[model samples]
Target: MIADSGLVDGLRPSPNFGERRGHSRPEMLIMHYTGMADGESALRWMCMERSQVSSHYLIQEDGGVVQLVCEADRAWHAGAGDWRGRDDINSRSIGIEIVNPGHEHGYRAYPPAQVASVLALGLDIVGRHAIPPENVLGHSDVAPGRKQDPGELFPWADLAAAGLGHFVRPERLSGGRFFGRGDSGEPVAAFQSMLAAYGYGIDPTGDFDERTRAVTIAFQQHFRPCKVDGIADMSTITTLYRLLGALASSPLAAQGGSRGAIRTA
Candidate 1:
C-alpha cells in the first residue's frame, strides 16, 4: 500500500477497513495510543484480520512512522463513540496510533523524539485536510466510556504551541463548589449543555449521571490535565468556559466544531 504522507517511512497494510459510509473525506484527526508492550506488536495486532482494528498511521517509540491504512479508507479504530451529535466517527476521522503502554500497562511519559515526530505528522494531516483545531482529538475524547488511549500524559500543549489543536492553560485548582455524579439541578443541566456545545455527547437532563461523569473525565483528560477526577470543579468549569470562548472567536469554529462534521481528537 502507498503511504498517504511523506512522513511515513514504510507500510504494513491492515485489512480492517472499509468505505467511509456517508462521508466524502476525513474532516477530523483522531489520536490513539497502542497500549501494548511494544510498537511492533501493536502494529502486528492491527494488521491481523482477526483483531479487526486499524489506523491510518502509527508512530513508533523511536520516532519511526508506519502507514497501516490509507487515509482515503475508513479504518476501524474508533468503535462506539459520539461527538457533537455525530456518531459515525470512523467515517469522518483519520486515525493515528501513537506507541504507548497506556494506563493499564506501564504508562509513562512520551519520548521527546517520538513526540516531535507525532507533532510533525499531526500538523501535516491537519494542514492538508484543513481539520479545525477542535477536530484534532484524543481517542478518549470521542469514546469516553469505552476507551482512554492517548491519555493525559500526551503532549497536547506542545501540539497547541505548534497550532495543531484547541488548548488553554487550565484554571488553577482550589477549594470551590463542584459537581459530580448523583448531583441534580439546573446547574447540572447547564454544565451538561456546555459540554455538549463543546462537542462532548451528553444530554442536559438536570441530573449528573455516569455518562456525564465519563464525559467529564474525558474533558479533563484533554483540557484540565492537572486533574482527571471526573469532578466538575471550578478549575474544570472555568477551563471549559474559556475554551468555548476561544472557539467562538476562532475562524474555524464558524465552519464547525469538528470542521464539517462536529466532534473529538
Candidate 2:
C-alpha cells in the first residue's frame, strides 16, 4: 500500500485488489458512491472475500475518510468502463467511493458535509497525483449504461468550484429544439463526434442509437443536471460545445486553434 496522501483518517484494508497491470501508475481519479444504505455495509461488502469488489478509499457522510485499497493497486471499481481510448480504467485510475444509497434504493442528494469532505479530499488527491482537471470524473461518466450511483445530485458544480473536477455553467434548458432516441442523420453524427472529441466513449455514428442516448444522459447528469431524460436538447448540445471551447481555450491547445474545434454539424 502506497501512502502518498494521509488525508484518510482511517485505514481499513481490503483483499479484493491486485497489482496494476504493466506497472501502470494512476493518471486519473474516479469517484463513486457506495450505493448501499450506509458506509459500514459497503465497507463490509468490499472487505468480504466473496464480494470481490473494493475501492482505494470510502468517504462517509460525516466527513470521515477511510482507505481500503492502495494507490498502486487496481481496485475493482471501474469494471467494463472506458475513458478516452483506454479500456483498462482501473489500471490507470484511483477510485474513491462515497457513501450513498444510490439509485437502486432511492438515491438521495449527498449531505453538504459529505460534499465538502469530498471536495477537500479530492483536491488533495488530484493535486498530489498531478492529475488533469478533466481526469477527475464520476463513475457514471465512465460506465453510464451500467451505473448511476453518485447521481446528478452529487454537486459536481461545487467540486468544480473547488478545482477538483472539470465543469462549466450549463445553458438553461428551453423547449426550443431537441433530439432523442429516434433522431438520426448528420446532426446526430455531429453530436456524437463532439462527445467523442471530449473523451466520451461514443462512436461518431450518424444514427442516434441506444448507446448515444445513454452517453447523452450521462453527460447531462454530470454537466447539465437540470434534466437527465436521455434527450439531448439545445442546452445539452450548447453546453457540450462551450465545454469543448473551454478545453480548446486552455493552455494545452493554445499553440494552434486549427484542430481544436471540429464542426461535425
Candidate 3:
C-alpha cells in the first residue's frame, strides 16, 4: 500500500484494517503509545494479523515514521470508545501510535526527535484534513478507564505550542472545594455537562460515579498533568472551563451551530 504522508520514512502494511464506515474521511486524530519494549516489537505486533490492531502511523524514538495502514482505511486502533456522543471511533478517526514502553514497562518521557516527528506529522495530517484543534486527542480521552497510552508524561503542551492540539495554561493547583466519587448534587451534574460538551463521552448523571472519576482522570491527564487524582479540584475545573471557553472561537464552533457551547457560570 502507498504511504499517505510524505513524512513517512518507511511502510509496513498491516492487514488489520478495513473501510471506514459512515464517514468518508477522518474527523478526529487519536494519539497512542505502543506499550511495548521498543519500536520494532510494536511494529511487528501491529503487522501481525493475530494482533488485530493497527494504526495509520508509528513514530520511532529516533524520529523515523512508519506507515502501517492507509489513511483511507479504518485502522483497528481505538477499540470500544465514544467521543461527542458518537461511537465507532476507528471509523471516524486516524490513529498514530507513538513508540514508548508505557506505564506497564518504563513510561519514560518521549525523546526530542520523536516529539518533533510527532509535531510535524500531526500538523501535516490536521492541515490536509482540516481537523479541528479540539479533535486532536489522546487515547485516554476517548477510552478512559480502559486505556491510558500516551500517558500524562506525553508532551501535550509541547504539541499545543507547535499548533497541533487544543490546550490552555492549566490553573495553579491549590486547596479548594473539590468533588470526588460519592459526591452527588447539581455541582456534579454541571461538571459532567461541561465535560460532555467538550467532546468527552460522559453522562450528566449528577452522581460522581466510577465513570465520572475515570473521565476526570482522562481530562487531567491531557489538560492538567501536574496532578491527576480523578478528583474535580479547582485546578481541574478551571482548566476545563477555560478549554470550553476557548471553543467559542474554534473552527468547530464556526460550523454554523452551537457545537461547543456550555454554561460557564
Best by lDDT: 3
What TM-score, to 2 decimals, does candidate 3 have? 0.94
Give the backbone clash total of model 3.
0
Each prediction's total of clashing residue pairs, residues at least 3 apart in sequence or on different chains, is 4, 0, 0
For lDDT, candidate 1 versus 3, the one ahead is: 3
lDDT of 2 by residue, 1-265 (tens): 5555667788889999988987457888998989888999999999997998999999999989889898888989889889887888888899999999888877988988888888888888888778888888888888878887678898988888878788999998787556789878777777777787777899977788899999998899899998889987888988887787777344324323322232233
Best by TM-score: 3
- Give the number of colliding residue pairs in candidate 2: 0
TM-score-wise, the better of 2 and 3 is 3
Model 3: which residue pairs collide? none
- Which candidate, 1 or 3, would have the higher TM-score against the true structure? 3
For each candidate, the alpha-carbon lDDT, in order, equals 0.87, 0.83, 0.90
Which stretches of candidate 3 lie above 4 Å from their native place?
Answer: 249-265
Residue pairs in candidate 2 whose N, alpha carbon or C atoms collide under 3 angstroms? none
How does model 2 fare in lDDT? 0.83
Q: How would the candidate models be sorted by TM-score, starting from the highest? A: 3, 1, 2
